[model samples]
Target chain A: MDMVRNFHMAQGLGETSYAQNSPLQKEVIESVMDITLRSAMEACAAETVSIADLGCSSGRNTLSVVENVIRAVCERRREATQQLPEFMVFLNDLPSNDFNTLFSLVPEFVQKLKAEHDDGGGILVSVAGAPGNFYGRLFPSSSLHFITSFTSLHWLSQVPAGLLNNEESVNKGNIYMSPASPPLVATLYFERFQKDFNMFLRSRSQELVVGGKMVFSFIGRRSHDSHEKINECLLLEALEKSLSILVSQKLVTEEKLDSFNLPFYAPSTQELEDQVYREGSFTIDSMKQAHDWTIHEYAPKMLSNFSRAIIESFICHHFGEEIIEPLFETYTQLLCEKLVAREDIGWSKIIVVLCKSAAS
Target chain B: MDMVRNFHMAQGLGETSYAQNSPLQKEVIESVMDITLRSAMEACAAETVSIADLGCSSGRNTLSVVENVIRAVCERRREATQQLPEFMVFLNDLPSNDFNTLFSLVPEFVQKLKAEHDDGGGILVSVAGAPGNFYGRLFPSSSLHFITSFTSLHWLSQVPAGLLNNEESVNKGNIYMSPASPPLVATLYFERFQKDFNMFLRSRSQELVVGGKMVFSFIGRRSHDSHEKINECLLLEALEKSLSILVSQKLVTEEKLDSFNLPFYAPSTQELEDQVYREGSFTIDSMKQAHDWTIHEYAPKMLSNFSRAIIESFICHHFGEEIIEPLFETYTQLLCEKLVAREDIGWSKIIVVLCKSAAS
Candidate 1:
């Protein structure tokens, strides 16, 4: 399936929707708020600052990051005794994203921002939705001054090619890179990430100004090996187990499960740095690994709902919608057992700040 | 009701949707294609042309105009043997508009444009949705080069405020400024139009660069009097008749019908010229009135469907959804009788081409 045409988070504001289940993403945003604020302030030196939140799904989390950036820029300008600059924010995601819900939330967001600017000169914020794949071009040349993407870049433009040899699934019994998968499976996934990430960098290089900064936070692994046992990988293993159970019960076909692999990859810090350097347009300002240990505090059902929100569209596109309820139920039960045993529920997040090189 | 929050064409692609029943709008667009093409070519003299379609509701009609603009720009450049410039198009509408449907139509629209450009250098087009009320600021200062709002400016920012006197509806029998409306009703509506039009022009002036061009096509009347007998006024009379029937049937309350008025005004050529001169930002290039006689050929049911598509949202907001079916049934029957009587159905459309003054 074409990712651009079909991929999306669970739409709307229901209990199973991404809008209602993105507290984990909100936590990631808060954890990296300082870096986002600093980058936004530095980028706001211009008279009109253009900031784009790539892969900004439908939720308050999307605008909360933008709100933080705008507030920081306003405070910094006031401190320096400079005029508050106009802000043109672009909220970007795949075309299949829930843009209606995102836009329905804009009036109140703009109202609150304007209200907060009562003491200073009035704030000027214009938010537009730019819907497209971030792996390609989305803006004009030298148009954006700051960019942020939270927990979004792990999604490759498409499922990795070459996962099949002679029309047979090479990575059977697994939905993502795992220790049980063959080495070639990891190679194919890594190669796809390298290609997609490089294209992303190249596109942003043309769109961003010379001194523009970008802050990105996405799921990551601690080891350089692609087949490491990260928390995300473990979660996928539990999901695979649930699907396998369904397959054994004749609820889903074995061939369907074998043919399914998520279009995702959690890169290591070294891997991210290497790709950025190889792209040769951006200079890494800072890179840090953060481990959020709060996952153990959440009920297993909540975690299951969160995961479902993120992956339900993908699963439905492949396995059909009938499997969602049973699939999530089994996965939630497995998660309960794992959480009760306290089996390393920590999630490792990588935050990177990069600036467009002046000489590029 | 909040116009910015509740105002939109009917949502989705169902039979009653604006997307499915916009042939009259399509005719208006085709009628003004020459003016649109001229303004687009003039605006494309720059390297990167920024074009905005204000009040671009969800439908193919929205992108058809932009497609014409891009084609004309490309042809002009290829004739001059200049490098193909990138086009940045912004689709502006209310936040409540069905942007998902609009954005869904984009990939195919863009792919067709690119495929047609295969003989020339590859086309570079980026389309984004700018959701907001056009009566206020939407873009940064001097950011756009061309603007188009077809059949949309007739909508005022809100209903005229003085329709009531001491808690009593002044225009009790009519939903718009008909010949039977009081002189004060006409005055209030015209004053609202003047204020909203001035605000719209002012906002566009700030967003449009010097020498930029804008083409606007909207419903108009031949007579200078706001209470003149126009086809649109006649159509609203039919709608008012249908609503009165519902009120008598107790399906809708009399108070509800009395307090409801359309936030719309059709200006004469003289009124439009006066407003343009009074605003003092844009110079009138040309103004002409075009009458579409083809509307008479359509079935009365088709025309009633068209009207319903445009006003269903407004109706559903004020009246309950249960009244829609019966109301439109009465409207279609009324239209059939009017059509059989050979009533005048010619729609007067005013097309104005304006250029941003260099001095401004």
Candidate 2:
């Protein structure tokens, strides 16, 4: 998933406005935190609980969401006793994520949260960091009572291998999920998503306690066909154009260029539901499609970083820096063309909050 | 001139954002008024003088600039006679303009102005309409004391006949300013601008009274060399692409589509200065380039309405309404592509305030 790595690196250089400005995610996550923590407080009948945000890049937003959850839990606990529970938060992300950036701001965030809760007069909150990919396993099993991942998930470590292979379904001209392209690319895309999603459920099932709750939000397509409106498809087209420009310019050998494709695909809402149901280990409590968004509010920054961090680095790493500028310009032009053509109706994000089944 | 007609119609609908967000223009023109009116009041040495906004479409922004000028002049006059001049305003546009739209709001505007001025004691102001193009002569000679046009003067009523007749120049394609195009297009564009501009000045010379300050703030480019940036050329290329799509769909005949070109040209700062100096009529006191602005802000809306107002009624008049949507989409896509591809540098604006040379 060098593609994923590149994407993160590139998008990190500039402001990821979408991640920063998603009031929708912020509001929804806050509500989810309140609901889930209140339920946890009632179920545990314990003094306090720990919440973990797995794959929490920068950890700032993660701490915020967890703070809200703790507040709600403590508010409920305060109803019965004069003393409040001491809450702990573990913020996790890839090891390479700017943990220092997150840590530097931790003191300020903690102080602010303390001041806010000072009036309530009892709850104590502490935050810790755990930097690792959630796919392999990050946190200790049964350690996290409540977990959340907003605007993440749905991303596999890499593009599904079957998509790149011809024998399996869903391959079209070595291109996948682009506009004015064959339908098979989209089909292959969705099938791969189904496989990866099953893996996510299996992994999450092993990590969570029987009563643990996990909330995940991810990018998705509006329709179930999967043959249309795939988010990653547009990004791939941009990469393809950039690659072709590289090959034509002789920046990279044609063989090296042809051997790779980006490893991301946004699943459809119906397809996601189907995947989770098949896992059978977890019971979904709630799932909602965040179909509409203000891309202008977030896209420009995300895209700027995506081009610089991922595309430029990928091209430079494989070939050299010679083709970087051309590749970026071509990629940006292609992306803008696709965006305007789509009229900004490109991606649908899905939010799902689920609990491990009693049987499991 | 029909092209200019299209521009005037589209100015409000597609080609100009200023028409919709008058407040933006109001901010700039208000400052210009503050400067010009102070100078005009000083030049005339009169306590009270009339002010008019030439080609002030819908009179919204014109009223604002006028109101500000009147208020300022009254403030100055209060120091002397304790009376404000009987301020009269003439909001001018073409016969085809939305006069009813302008008139409907006049009562409220006048009442508000009166109320604001009344609070400052006694500053009388009355407003009326001038429904005619400034190009052909709107006001009676020497009848007005002060006039301001925030951003309307760069437009010529028609593309220059010299450039239109020169097949070589016209055939080069996009015979106006556009970035990333041939230098010849800018050369031809400026040459044509010189001719039409000479006419513009020759005409304006007869309209303004001695010491009457007319300010023209409009879209312009940075470089004197038309070769470097030809924004207008890009706009036409986009239009040609749209036309090509029409020909492919057999929506319009190739010959008819081929003959058409846009009439508007955004001039550079030097070009405006040269034209004013060559006119031997108006003496430019101050010319400053305002912030760069995108024509795309208004062009999309204007292009949408072009079919109903002019193109459908003229070029594609025989074609069914079914062709309209496709034409617009095709046009917008092409324009957006061209715009997105180039350096995000072209499409700027300039504001110049000139006084009719008393010596002339």
Q: Estimate the TM-score of every prediction.
A: 0.98, 0.43
The residue-by-residue lDDT of candidate 2 on B119-155, one tens digit each, is 5544444344444445544443454566666556555
Q: What is the C-alpha lDDT of each candidate?
A: 0.90, 0.58
> What tens-digit string does per-residue lDDT give for candidate 1 at A292-350?
88888788899999999999999999999999999999999998988887667777899
lDDT of 1 at A352: 95
CA deviation > 4 Å runs, candidate 1: A119-121, B118-121
The per-residue C-alpha lDDT of model 1 at residue A129 equals 94
TM-score of chain A of each: 0.98, 0.77
Worst 10-residue lDDT window for candidate 1 chain B reads B226-235
Predicted model with the maximum DockQ:
1
Those runs of model 2 whose alpha carbons end farther than 4 Å from true positions after fitting are A1-45, A80-82, A119-122, A162-192, A229-239, A245-254, A297-302, A306-325, A335-344, B1-360
